[model samples]
Target: MVRANRRLLRARYGRYEGGPDPLAAPVDLTEALDAIGEDVMAGSSPERAMREFLRRGGSDRAGLDDLARRVAERRRDLTRKHNLDGTLQQVKELLEKAVLAERKQLARDTEMDDGDRMLAEMQLDALPASPAAAVSELGAYDWKSSEARADFEKIKDLLGREMLDQRFAGMKDALENATDEDRAAITEMMTDLNALLDAHTRGEDTPEQFDEFMRKHGDYFPDNPTTIDELLDSLARRAAAAQRMRNSMSQEQRDELDALAQQAFGSPELMQSLSQLDGTLRALRPGENWGGSEQMDGEQGLGLGDGTGVFQDIAELDALSDQLSQSYEGSRMDDLDLDALSRQLGDEAAVDARTLQQLEKALRDSGTLKRGSDGQLKLTPKAMRQLGKALLRDVASRMSGRQGNRDLRQAGAAGERSGATREWAFGDTEAWDVTRTITNALTRTAGEGGDTTAGIRIEIGDVEVQETEARTQACVALLVDTSFSMAMDGRWVPMKRTALALHSLITSRFRGDDLQLIAFGRHAEVMDIEQLTGLDAQYDKGTNLHHALLLANRHFRKHPNAQPVLLVVTDGEPTSHLEASGDVFFSYPPHPVTVAVAVRELDNSMRLGAQTTFFRLGEDPGLARFIDSMAKRVGGTVVAPELDDLGAAVVSSYLSSRRSGGSGGAGEDFDGMFGRGWGRWG
Candidate 1:
């Protein structure tokens, strides 16, 4: 063998940082579809079902509600874990250190005048009890220790930076050891910001003015908003959070901070500029929560800048919680801010929310759900087929004696040989006849007079397989009770599932067969599988099996050549009958006329030679006795399976009747096939 060209591939590994993962698997919509389908079958609209599934989430993913809960928990923890008295405490510690160092310096100095030293001691001792008051009173005091003087100046610097930091983020670190130039620049920036806001309020602002202001003070705002609205949103949110932080403090603490504000930067100008900024932000963005307060109970303290940051976090969390709720009017999944969510709750939460959004979009975009002319979301026909196949698989798993029969029985697969041979076609899985194939090859060559002397070469035209008789086509009518009892006793979804499973089997495996879903409450009407699955429960006080049987007989008449297979799922006896006037007459305790009418209709069905089975649902003794009597009257079968097993029981009975060729004479054999302890009552 010739040597093949070889290529060597090298793989490199590194830490994964941000963005979508290239190795991530494609999103799976099966779990979402199943949940949505189940809810739709339970009488919820498609839109409502989709929303409920996203809210409740799946086995492996957190839902919208779970994210909202985490947000709420984070907010609660912030309030419970820290108090806001850090700045004042720092001021007191620094002031105490400065005074202690000065007193020691005064004692160690030998060249100082006696009267002056005494005066200094008296002035230091005369300092006010409050830290803010003491700092303000020492504004003019002379200090001997250089360290003490520097510390005193640092206290003033701390206050000034914190004061600015409350309004603007990162100000504390940015203004450390700030020069006179930094202070003047901050004041100038504030003046420009206020002027810009005032011009915007009067509708006199232009894009050029905003651009010029950002060019001068853009460093102040790390958010770097490009538009006026964006800048206002950011500034207004922080200002409101700061105000809320002040509101959350005790009255005494608020008063102390108010007094301390006058000492920030050793001047009143900074406070005045900040107050103006706050006023302008509140005026421009009036909808921000400016008056809210929270309770803090923990011992850890947060300084002014840090406390405001916490409050801002709380504000973001509140907004996120609302987004997750999806309860506001005109809200959509796209309304959720994934970037902000990722910032607050990490990447996993953002992933969950994004996944939910993608799932909803896929459900609509993939043709699984579509808007009808009626302006309501409805399941498409493709969706119905997929959902029905899923139900059929569930039914198949519950079925017995066919471990290898995973697929529904396809047409022409019933292994009853007709002892004849025919040319094979595509998709034919029947076994080939060895003798027939060789004889056909020889006969073809002899007829052509070309391959008799040489060995007979078998062409595709000479190939043949044994033919099997096709199964009889079935005309099946599935009558499901939609009366108040079926809804009240929790048999609605199972009824729909059974109907869907049977519908799927016939439409998918036996396309030649005819299946009609007939739902009867106070009256009978024919519905397709989609309509039946999404049908809402009714509180009508009637079973109306009389009308249902009347409809079933009419269906059998429509297909006279096909075998009739009738399957009835009900939870009550006949309480209603169709009248000659084309109306329904209903009664409660089994009216004699209603029973007679129902029995008369059953006789009509028997005369038409329909194979019948009754699937009674509840434990009502009267229902059991009536169903048993009815089954005996027509030589049919009665099965009372649990709600979960109802679909399997109904499908198995249908298959048994189908195998019996749908002849009423094969009732004994049909019962024998379904007599596997399937809760037969008659």
Candidate 2:
């Protein structure tokens, strides 16, 4: 019963007998959908896959839509099959909330941690007391809340202190007579002494009585000490003891201490105190001394007069404000009001509101955008992909058309069968004559259905077959003009699109053919078909057709019998080349040298049994004259096709050449290039 059903299916849908099985053969859609689904699951979208499909000459929208639907369905089915839907959704939501919480906590932690750590440490040291009293005892100032007048008075009192002048005088004398090594040693001692004094004033000293002694006599210290090494040794001992005390605290204990200290002294008053101390320390330098007979004006002399001091005081405030603004900017993802964007793009535009909305949702879902406190929009990698997809769609749409005369083939070799029968081979396709084999066996068995005899003959007539020889061979080189002039006429993009389409055609349709891409501006370089989509014309000196043709010839040299052909797409004539002295020579108005060089390259190509075709953009009479001359000289063809006809022209030219036994025949007919009986509207 199964065998009968199988025969019936074969009779209904199978291919021709002794030929390829049409139903069993792989369809392009199955392959494309497989690839598209792979990309989609790897975080691509239907629109993106569709755009890529179109760019690769899968230009039928209905067909692509079907493939997209299949891909989506496949993705959904796979998600269900692997039991990943609910798990993925849960994971996504959990990760999203966790990430958002993390970001918020990080910002709060960072802002609260800066400069507050010092005040917090101070508060911790002075525990078991009110924070305000501890801060006052530590000389903490509230610069923001204090009257400007009070700050000015404090600045005056600090500048007029007698200790600063004495220190300056001692430092000036020490520096004037010291040798380099003595100066270096004294400088090192002063640095250590200053650090020690700072640590003592900050109440961070160990062996508590020594800290008190330093606080009392720190004013007697010199800027540069004669006993430099001794001072450093003393400071190092103190620092080591302090470090040991710090290391004795456990992680949890340290964290608790830090948190408690933060709660106590993380206030405006503590910050002002640190700022005032920093200012006073800065004033201790030699040039900054204001305690002399000068009796400096408190406001003008210290660059702290009138509003200047206020500006200095508020510098950090301004920085904080700026940081807030940047944070708002970075976190805001709602800035692009989708409703407004949809309206702005308009319903009739290439990208509709729904498409934009889908893109925005994709971005949001992908975590590429987040909403800020101010309700502004922030862009993420997801948003970037959306934008990229939109751009790619626009570009691919602009370049869509029925292109090239050659029938685009798949990437692998297609089999062709000969009429003559051969002995059945091991690798032959299974579509061969099974009925003939069984009939021959039956006749040898004298028409018996259950013959078990040993003398059953296997004849040549019952043998199955497959191809044994190479049926098709072709080698093509695509030369693109990447000169600045191509961009001048807005022709570079179209040229790139044409190259991409041709590449897609040859690679996808005629995979057995050898294809090489070479780009030329001021120079020529070999490129790949895959690289054409991203090709941009170079801003160089001038077009050099001679160099490009010579390079193309060299590329095709190894493939001597594969029907070698060159397709040159350029907007201008040759204008540059290397001279005998190896210096670049450029000329306009058809220099004889340049013309001779171009002709010589073409001559060499022809000599090696290769054909060259030129596709010119824009109608320059001079370029036309040169092209006509070249075409006649090489017996090739020149096409000055309009944009719409470009695809047909290319396809027609290639197919015509292919059918003409691989020779450069002029003006071969290509009226049916698109397909047999395919009509062109207007």
The TM-scores, one per candidate, come to 0.87, 0.38
Off by over 4 Å in 1: 1-24, 400-406, 409-469, 663-682
| Top candidate when judged by lDDT against the true structure | 1
Could you give candidate 2's per-residue lDDT for residues 1-682 as a string of tens digits? Answer: 9999999878755324543234442223423333333233233454354334332323322232332343344333322333112211232343334334433443455456656645544443453343223223334422222232233233222222211221232332233333546534544444544555466456564554344444544443533333333333333322322222223334543343233222211233322332333343443322321221111112221111111222222222233233222234342222223333223233232122223223334444555445656664343334333433433333333332334322222111123544433445322332455656666666756755555465666665555443222245668887888888876666665565565556555554456678888888777778764344335446776777777887778877878768777788887888886566756677765478987888898898877766667887787888888887887787777888776555445554655565454533623433332323334321
lDDT minimum window of 10 residues, candidate 2? 300-309
Among the numbered candidates, top TM-score falls to 1
Clashing pairs in 1: none
Model 1 C-alpha lDDT per residue in residues 1-682, reported as the tens digit of each score: 1233232234456746666566767678788877888899999999888888889988898888899888999889999999998898898899999999999999999999999999999999999898878988888889999989989998889999998888888999999999999988988998899899999999999999999999999999998999999999988888898999999999988988888888888879888888988988888888999999999878889889989999999988988988888889767788888888988889889889888887777888999999999988999888888888888888867763333332334324344787877775444567787888888899988998776778899987778878765478788899999999888988889999899889988888767779988999999899988889999989989989889989899999999988888889999998999999999999989899999999998888888878888998988898899999998999888888888888888887777677678544433343343233433422
